[model samples]
Target chain A: MNEYKRISPSKRFLINIVLVIIFIVVGTLLTGGDSLSRASRALILQIGIYVILAVSLNIATGYLGQLPLGHAGFMAVGAYSAALFWKATLNMPTPVSIVLGLIIAGLIAAVFGIIIGIPALRLKGDYLAIITLGFGEIIRIAIINLSGITGGTPGLLNVPKYSSFLVVFLCVAATIAAIHFIMHSRHGRAILSIRENEIAADSCGVNLTYYKVLAFAMSAFFAGIAGALYAGFQGSLFPKSFDFMASINILVMVVLGGMGSMLGSVIAATVLTALPLVLQALAAYRMVIYSILLIIVMIFKPSGLLGRYDFSLPGLIEKWMNRKNKPGKEVANE
Target chain B: MVFLQQLINGLQLGSIYALIALGYSMVYGIILLLNFAHGDIIMVGGYIVLLIIAAGISPAVAIAACIIGCIVLACVIEKVAYTPLRSAPRISLLITAIGVSFFLENVAQLLWGADPRVFPATRIIPATSYQIGRLTISLTTIVTLVVAIAAMVVLMLLVQKSKMGKAMRAVSEDMGAAQLMGINLNRIITFTFAVGACLAAIGAILYCCKYPQVKPTTGYILGIKAFVAAVLGGIGSIPGAVLGGIAIGLAEVAVNALGYSTWTDAVVFVILIIVLLVKPTGFMGASMNEKV
Candidate 1:
């Protein structure tokens, strides 16, 4: 016990940082850079984008405990903004324009997130779901009707392909880090308190509106960045791709992996993104399978695979050390 | 004359919406589930009619089978998918409902290709038009309006005067109390799903008759709009669903008349949002505080 206390908080954080770096290096080495087939590379890149989407959605649906069914709308907004920015700034250096597009996409989507979140989040659970769903449909319809700007149903073309594996990897890492930081912070605790009990959270002086909107905006921001990456990767944009089905697909990832668990989102997103590609012959049956999985998961484990459990290497290490030193104390706490 | 024609058109569409909305309202009132699968039951009904007609069965027989098929499907869904999740979190139930909805849509797609099937209409419903003063309305529209109104009356009577209806009301009011009072909660819930499914089948037939094309996803959009109508009219109130349906139908027609057909869906959602914001309980729905 005495030695465990002597280790210090900063020392533990450094050890965690070192462990993370080692894991990343090992992961990169195992992935095999250029030896990976083109299809595999594409899949990896797609997984990164989906990781960002699933994690960001977890922030809203899992942590905040509010279901917003229109996540695709924000993504659509981000994609169009980024694609249009690239199109307009063709004269600029590719790297400079790409970064600018991402920032612009995220900021624009954040603005929309705040605008929609304010009124929509005021309503309770299912109402928020439908209203957000309505907003998603409206966004798609607007994209179709405003043909001149959105290029109509034919879809916008000639978006630059700046979404390389390195860029996507970096973005995914940044997204995970940012979300992890926010979720572990005091603000995250406040948001989580709201999820556990809104009335109690309110009585305790948590600013419901402010935190709700903030979480929503942050989720939208990352989704927007993911959308921008998608636009750059696909080199085109279609409103049809970002409909209600797409939203449900992301929701499935969050639910299947385990709500309120970031690692669960990452694992689910990666597995689901790869599942379709692996079973290309049975592509038609993919959605049916997804639906079945969703129902089964809900029926059997509604809390999800991870439930409320979050993986923490440091926490695990600390517990192990405590057990070695004084097992009775840890047992008593449990 | 054009205005009168649009009115007839709006009424035709509204009545169909009302028929579907009634199903939504009934189920929601009793079980508090949005019944996302309710709309897909309409799709199943259409496919049954399509297949039966293609196989040389009489239209009347096919219609009967369609109604029965919908009821069976709704019952099966409730028993298999929803029963176990009754005590789960509301969000979980909603997600499961969505899963059921997607499952139905995909199953339809796999069974009958994603392409819209050209519903053989001439043999199903007569295509004749009737002249009224300076305006002309099709026979199908008149038939649809009459059938919808008749069904509404029958349903209203059934709910107000019947024993099963009273049981439903009691269960909805207080499930525990109703059970203690000897009402079979499961049976009442099943009965509600059946009634809702039956109404959806009728609406499906009417909708197929008017639109004449059936796709795997045909029910998806209509289902959403009907749900909106149910909410608009007061989800648990029978008459309110009809009112909301007609209002939405007219609004859709008006938007089309104003030469912005593409905006109809968006406009409907905007209206839904506005209504929800102003009166979250909907037009005829009881106040939120009454549940306690």
Candidate 2:
């Protein structure tokens, strides 16, 4: 069992800690030792928000093996809910306001998740996708029509940007840690079983409907929390900001990282969030390049960049040289 | 009088929606892929029509030219975006189609900018309408309905009775089995997109007649509404798509009449969620038993 298992839990946990340390150090240097500069702070906040979005989506498209194009709709719910809450409770501190915002947004989205999942979960493949797409569009348009509260097309602005890096980072960490916990739990096993074979899983007594809805519910909940965090960070909100494009962005992030791989998602979100800024030379062509790359990735690496593997510095380096220098490969003719 | 006006508007709008939704339903009926970029291809067709008009051509000439142009572009998209991933999972194809949609929309924005432009509206659209008792109907309404219903019937006949229709149906049902029976799968897929795009071109012309304005982002919302219409009718059922479009059209009119235009998008979604809950297979969607 030890030989077959290949990697130990303690070592894996240690590897995560090491990576976290590395990321923190790099983030500090990139921010020039201060996280308050408008651009630097904004980048950090974006990473945190994307981490939230990408990881939550990993549950539906990644772990549950469902394609949901309506994640941004739920995010819009959270954004508006958080904005309303913050406005109503203007006297609260930043942290409490953010927490209340998270709870409110999460509850609202989870309710919606159940509504969307019930009918949609029954359909397989692209039918489910279309329903989700419809759901997303409806959310965007609804925001536009209800101009009285949502401010319609003009959007809500000057939201009082009170979010700091510490708040954002901590929220991101909790979000990631929660996802890790869920993945390692029994619920994760049920999700994977359903993804592998729904009929077979059902035959074995797995409640297919329950699990599918549960996945969507959890996804919506976290996405809501992320939206609340986003509202605080952006200090302004608009329905257009949480449009279909936003949902597609999250989907791309989830797909670009290996689906069903949590570590891959975190890494993908960070790199992609930083990518446009990092490669500023072709900013105008970002969508074009991104779209092309997305197609290329789907064609060549449908399993995504990591192919269901996690990043481990030591394990990777050890395996890296050993892999290439095999004296006599156990290669077989294809 | 207002009710009569709204009914006329609804029928005209509904017919255009029905036109595009038919293509969406037909393609989906055969292959479950949504081809999300189908609407953008319509947008592209409008641009093509506009270009031809600008090149010293009449509307009739431009319409014919643009129909051919739309077919070519749609076929090329299928070849470039979908052909390579045919054997991959269904979800991958859906995402690729989405990427294609983004590519086209961005390309339009790059070229046309974001400003809304009016299509050339002819004086033929009557300024007023004739009343029949309490109900009034306009020529535009009559023409659009006549054109849409006629097109749908012909398409139904072709799909159900024609020899090529048999080949298309055979391919849609099961590609491997169809290929084993000596059918060309690529030709069928290309033909499907071409036909779908051509219908979309007709829909574009009708939409331009009613709204008279087209912009890069015009397809975004209409695309969603038409998709809802497709799903509402029973995704793979052609008749279902037409019915769904009419229902959504009526519902949109009702929402406006009720003084709740603000809730139009919301109401449509609520309808979808409710429908999905009541009948997950959609109004006409069928359940195919998966081979374990």
Candidate 3:
């Protein structure tokens, strides 16, 4: 236990390996078995998807200090690319097909990310926000009209559902760990500096252009991973799935979770994703309540519940034990 | 003849873009807030107009009611969403505005369901068509173009000739100094929002008349395009919004004519990115120097 300071950066690899093992083991247990184990597995995969989305988006929106409303566009790119690749590799081994899909989606999304990131990075505030939004709409509209390649109004379906909870969880956990490593490293700090004060970062010899592109590419890369997994999980996704509205929903989840805190993003993702199922009785007013809650939360804790705070077991123990049986969402609901 | 028709159509729709961009430019000029809710407010206007039409109200009355409703909604948004975040940083307020935009759209869907409903079909302008020199124009197009131009001219006068206009210009130039000069910040913002919303109401009515179908989410995309136009024209500059909107409108038409309607957003952004890359101040905008 006298290893806190003695553990050099090279030894940090061990800590990462341990974290990966924990991520995989917990996911397998949650998704194990057959029959009634269905609901938990679905829930686990959904959480995995949210984690990937929040972490990747945390780069552009939270880390880089840019607000991009059209991330779902990249998700669409990955989803369609992976779905096509998966269909082509139907006869290949499951692992081969999954790897191929991930590669295809990630590569395509990264290319598009650079194209978008380069030009839009010139401006800040509302300018970046609207430009990204326009890009999203452009991609969606192109997909819709290019029915020949993209299947038009009817998106590709019957994708190989190879996205087991373990697979999804590993990708997400890897994304978070990778992002965390980057954030703590020299490059990551440079990105954070850009977020905090671009001028200062520029003055401090940080190549703003390179770091900005690096951040956006990283964000797109993980977003593509999430999209690839989504294609395999959903079995089918319409072009409408990647519309502006869905992008906003993901943005809301990330924002509500508290930006920059991977822990906040995880909790917000879990709570928001599960709330609907928990309050099925009040389903009719789901959005109204959600909106009201958002307003109230913004008015009070504008930074969110765990604003830039991590989700440690001790924090959960303190809140859960002190509070009543929670407002909604439990195993019974599932 | 085909080119002429498309050009006219572009002008008509571009005016709508111009109408909406006024709000973006004004708010950015004055408070430096992008007011992302500007688009959702347009959606609100469309929905209110739809309800009024559903009640069998006359088109004229509905348009009047719609304008009033939009004004109220805009003012409410300014007070609830923007005013409280006044002391916060620009980005915080922008995030709040985005949150509000999402809230309004989701709330609209929750209340009315997700279905895109049909607005009451009534021609606000006569559906007459006239042909001259191998060019054909409909009453709706003609009226929309004329009315849009008229509105712009009036806005120009308001900004250039009036005392309030001077205050607004002063504020846009420097809020801190404007406050020292004893101008009412809150009133000017409310008025700016009201003016923008009222303009959107007119555009909404005409949009319904032309398209004849209204959806709960109609305003979101249109709002973004208008904001793009504002940026292109050089935000905070009034003439810039008008010119930018017209350029966007013409570009959309030209793109469609060139067999690239699918790439309309992409094309619009390409042009915008090009402009920003070349001159970030926009067509009519001068670089703003913030006294940090």
Candidate 4:
């Protein structure tokens, strides 16, 4: 671990950049070709979207240590906003429209995050959960009732399918990087401190409300981006798609991935997103499996699968080098 | 006359909500944990009623079986899922409760299929109506109101006058202190869950008679709404639950009457948000002090 820390900041940055580039290149090569089936491509894209969703939720639930049950509400807001923006800018260049739509989606969701967070965050624990849930349901209801723009329950159609592999890959990488940077910064530490003990954090001069709202809005922002990607992938929007169950599904990913571990979130999201598809033969038992897994995991391993353990290439290499040096000594695993 | 009829309708619905809300209130009072599976317990009770009725059992026996089944399921869930997590963080307990709820719903779907079964309400509660001065009241409505009220009254007496009730109140007030005073914490907790389950089962029967259908997911919305009612009425307060339930029932009816039936769900949440904002403790909730 000491040897792992000896790697300077510049070297760490270089390593991260290389890893991301390798990931992007490999993803593009795998999905860019016509060799893979359409279903597989779609599945890969979906994994990317869910990865973003889980990580974004981790910002508030994992890092901030607050449970907001209305993540799907923010996603719904983003999905509809991006869908509307893209629908209106049909004549613009596709790339420009998609980029603008994503921004608008995220910003709109962030604005809502601020609006809801101010009141909702004042309460703690289960009250916060229920209040967020109420807000989420309200957002869906609003979308349904405002049929002139939202297209009501039947759904808004003709959304441009822009969530190709490259786009989704970049978005996923960007979300992870942004969250990673934010969590390492002073503000991120403040958020973590608050999660550990709110009163102590407050006494230490950390602004509780500001940081809480900030983490919440940032989480909402990324959730919005993921929602936009989802809208483009599906080419339609329905209020039903972003209901309480949808929120729970995203939450299940965050929980199943150890809370506060980005790598865990990514892996859990990937596995969960694919689990249903892989178990298509037992579709009826899929949710049953998920619920059972949730219960058993909570009971047996409440900290989750990884339990705050994150993966780092440099750390792995450091361990490998140490093992080589000590021959018989086993390097401890986290 | 229309207003009077709607008032009666509101009362019937409100009584059902009140019963469910009572369950939520009592459990929350005892453990400070929201039993998310409380509603699903009602769903299980609905299934039990359906099964028993199908087996050529008398309505009385079927109802008894449903109540007993709910009580047993609630106790089993407490022992299996929640007991181990007694020392875990509140969030973990909440998550486990959600897990238990989802498990119940999905398992029910796996066992009974997702399709809703028609509840034989007429066989259970006689289908009849009475009219007086242009006002009509269904026999089901009157029976639901009377039975719900009777149950509440019985529950009130039990809690206020019984030795077990005193122990329950003491435990809820301070668990460690009550245990030191020789109260059996485990027994009281299980007994609280059983009581809540009993109320939920009665609510389920009343709900099926009114709606005439039973589905796995039926409890989800009802549970949430009842939870909202519990919160609105000030959690841990019995009268508050009753008041909150009635208010919600009336608000829902009023929204539907205004010809915006689709918005009724949204309106209930709106009320919750507004109540939470204006009075975070709720209309009846005592302000809780955070311990260092």
Highest lDDT against the true fold, candidate: 4
Q: Tens digit of lDDT per residue, candidate 1, span A215-282?
A: 99999999999999999889999999899999999999999999999999999999999998888998
Of the candidates shown, which would achieve the greatest DockQ relative to the real structure?
1
lDDT of 4 by residue, B1-292 (tens): 8888898999889889999999999989989888999999999999999889999989899999999999999999999999998998888888888888998999999899899999999989889999888999999999999998899889888887899988888888888999999999999999999999999999999999999999999999899999999989899888788889988999899889889998998999999989998997677787432100
Q: Please list, in the order the candidates appear, how each scores on TM-score for chain B only.
A: 0.97, 0.92, 0.94, 0.97
DockQ, every prediction: 0.84, 0.61, 0.51, 0.74
Model 4 earns a TM-score of 0.96
Q: Tell me the RMSD of model 4 versus the true structure.
A: 3.0
Query: Which residue pairs show collisions in model 4?
Result: B234-B285
lDDT of each: 0.89, 0.80, 0.80, 0.90
lDDT string for model 4 (A176-286, tens) is 989988998999999999889999999999999999999999999999999999999999999999998899999999999988999999999999999888978988887
Candidate 2: residue B189 lDDT (0-100): 75
User: Model 1, residue B184: what's the lDDT?
Assistant: 91
> Which candidate should be chosen as best, given TM-score against the real structure?
4
TM-score of 3: 0.91
Task: Return the TM-score for each candidate structure.
Answer: 0.95, 0.89, 0.91, 0.96
Q: Evaluate residue B7 in candidate 3 and report its C-alpha lDDT on the 0 to 100 scale.
A: 91
Cα lDDT tens digits, model 3, A182-254, are: 9989999999999889899999999998999898888888888889999888998788999877787787777
